[model samples]
Target: MFASSLAVVLLTLAALLGAIVAFAWAWRKGHFHVDARAATLPFDDHDQRVARPWETPSQARERVQAHGPPLPPGPGEWGGA
Candidate 1:
């Protein structure tokens, strides 16, 4: 009798765990994300094919010359720029 009672408890626990796992699996696989698209997107199917921003000549020059002719550091901070 004790053995049968233990088995019942074990089976009930197993069923509960199985149901929880099944629900999680279905939620992950199904269209549960549809309603949350607005909040979830702008990242989910993120724009992979975005066009590169046009860089003006001055912007390019600023980026390229920001380092400027390797000016040496002053005082105790040597090792060229």
Candidate 2:
């Protein structure tokens, strides 16, 4: 049991050290750099998608009748007020 516990602790420490080294290497290599081009990746020409408009009151009522009332807003959603 002592050997096994020591092995577990050593493995965990090694994994954490490896992660830190990798992060430092990436930082030196500018892997963490952010640019406007990277920010627009999701909006590239190949992936031009738009959100549909919100449901009207009548549509919302129909949805309630067909599929039960919509779920209440989850945590942090205040419905803009």
Candidate 3:
């Protein structure tokens, strides 16, 4: 029982130490630094104007006002497999 408890404690400490080291390495390598452009890397022009079918005319107008006119979806752009 004592051996098992000690093993668990040692493993927990090792995992904690590993996480700390990984975080320090990432920090030193500037992995945490993010610019506005880099933050938008996953999105494109199409992502800016996705049509929401459920929106009422007023809601559509509000969306257009907030994000400019909505662009028509290209062929196969819909999630149909």
Candidate 4:
């Protein structure tokens, strides 16, 4: 049991050390230079897909009746409506 505990402690220390080294390497390579650009990546053209907005139960039932159950929209559709 003691040996297993020692191994776990060693592994934890190694993981922490590795994380510190990786962070240092990234810092040196200017990965942190452009804070705003990184923050806006989710808004880029390729990544700008909007999440499906919530609909009330009545709206869902109406949509199902009109459109035969909800599905992902085609290119021109907005919310499949």
Q: Could you say which candidate leads in TM-score?
A: 3
TM-score for all models, in order of appearance: 0.33, 0.39, 0.45, 0.37
Q: List the candidate 2 regions with Cα displacement exceeding 4 Å.
A: 1-3, 36-80
Candidate order, lDDT descending: 3, 4, 2, 1
Q: Candidate 2 on 1-81: residue-level lDDT in tens? A: 466988999999999999999999998999898675778665533222222136677876775665554665444443454
Q: Which residue pairs in model 1 clash with each other?
A: none
- Would you list the C-alpha lDDT of every candidate in the order shown? 0.56, 0.63, 0.80, 0.66
Cα shift from native, residue 7, model 3 (Å): 1.4
Off by over 4 Å in 1: 1-3, 31-81
Candidates sorted by TM-score, descending order?
Answer: 3, 2, 4, 1
> lDDT tens string, model 3, 3-77?
698899999999999999999999899998767578767767676676677779898888688778898766666
Candidate 3 regions with alpha-carbon error over 4 angstroms: 1-6, 17-31, 54-66
Candidate 4 lDDT by residue in tens digits, 11-46: 999999999999999999998887776786545332
Per-residue error for 59 in candidate 1, Å, reads: 45
C-alpha root-mean-square deviation, each candidate: 14.8, 13.9, 5.1, 10.8
Q: Between which residue pairs do clashes occur in model 3?
A: none
